[model samples]
Target: MATVKVTDLAHQDAQKMLSIINNQMPQLINQLNSTGQQMSDPNNWDGPLAQKFRGEVWPQAKADLEKMKNSLAQLQQSVQKILTNISHAGGA
Candidate 1:
């Protein structure tokens, strides 16, 4: 495969994307946490459906959110490495 050149623009774009992810991820987590709390609260919700949701769906969603966070962190690290490499190469 032909090696693609990494430029300053690419690094800038990657940084911007990472910035967006950093900004939005917390909002997503907060929303999930709020919803989870609401659903888990007996006063707010308590029934067979709520029990099933609290037992099943909430955990899966939380786990998936954690996985997504890990994946995004990996992506950010990879991008940082690429940016560092490009900087050392004097390409950015």
Candidate 2:
């Protein structure tokens, strides 16, 4: 049977990455929301192209953002699971 090894440093690094992802996600979401709001404002941007973007492209972008958020959450969960496994391996 093959052996697998995980180190304390790996666990720490994973935790740090998880923290970074958790922190950055909110900022990303806020930026996207602010951008969407700014673009949606007619006073800020108004034209047929803007309307087309708001009606078509904007919704797709929002959906893509939501998908990305879900993907990040999944990644966080996977990292948490790895941390749990590492702790169980006596690396915690």
Candidate 3:
């Protein structure tokens, strides 16, 4: 067995990346909600196939989108914790 340690992770870069992650999370959720509403609009479907897609495929896509949002939320929280830890550790 070998002991391994990680060092040299730039705090400024981590903070910048954290800023981006925080800013984009809401944007992504808003986009998903807007698109989901558009997809649910009945007027958008013209025929049986389109209706089927809206009814069937769209649900899975929506579920996946929800899962993605949840994962992003978790990641955001984790990143926030990391940033807090960084600050506590005398990082930028």
Candidate 4:
């Protein structure tokens, strides 16, 4: 079989990674907003469900948001690296 170049693989991976990140961004934003709202509401803080909801669920949601943000940042960096690689390969 044929050997594939690193540049070609990087570009393809970058595109796919960008697509996945873009698709997840809206859902992540919605979750972050919902969690923020819940945390901000005084009633939610004092409620019976607050122990589980706020302590566990909200914290997990916040962690998910952080993970999503980090993933997106990494994906952006990967795309930038791919573009740089492509440009340098073309100029050489």
Candidate 1 at residue 11, lDDT?
A: 77
Q: How close is candidate 2 to the true structure, as a TM-score?
A: 0.84
**What tens-digit string does per-residue lDDT give for candidate 2 at 1-92?**
86768887898999998997799786978799789978978899999999988899888988988888888989999998988888888887
Q: Which stretches in model 3 have alpha-carbon errors above 4 Å?
A: 1-9
Q: Give the per-residue lDDT digits (tens) of candidate 1, residues 1-92.
A: 86768778887887787786778876887798788868887799889999998899888887888888889888888877777787876776
lDDT of 4 by residue, 1-92 (tens): 85435556666776677666777676867777786767757675767676667677777777787787887778778776776666666621
Q: Give me the candidate number with maximum TM-score.
A: 2
What's the lDDT of the predicted structure labeled candidate 3?
0.74
TM-score of 4: 0.52
Question: Which 10-residue window in model 3 sums to the lowest lDDT?
Answer: 2-11
lDDT of 3 by residue, 17-90 (tens): 67777787668777977877786778964578768767887788878888887887788788888777777666
* Sort by lDDT, top down from the best: 2, 1, 3, 4
State the weakest 10-residue window (summed lDDT) of model 4: 2-11
Kindly report which residue stretches of model 1 are placed more than 4 angstroms away from their true locations once superposed: 1-4
TM-score of every candidate relative to the true structure: 0.75, 0.84, 0.72, 0.52
Q: Is candidate 2 or candidate 4 better by lDDT?
A: 2
The lDDT values for all models are 0.81, 0.87, 0.74, 0.69
Best by lDDT: 2
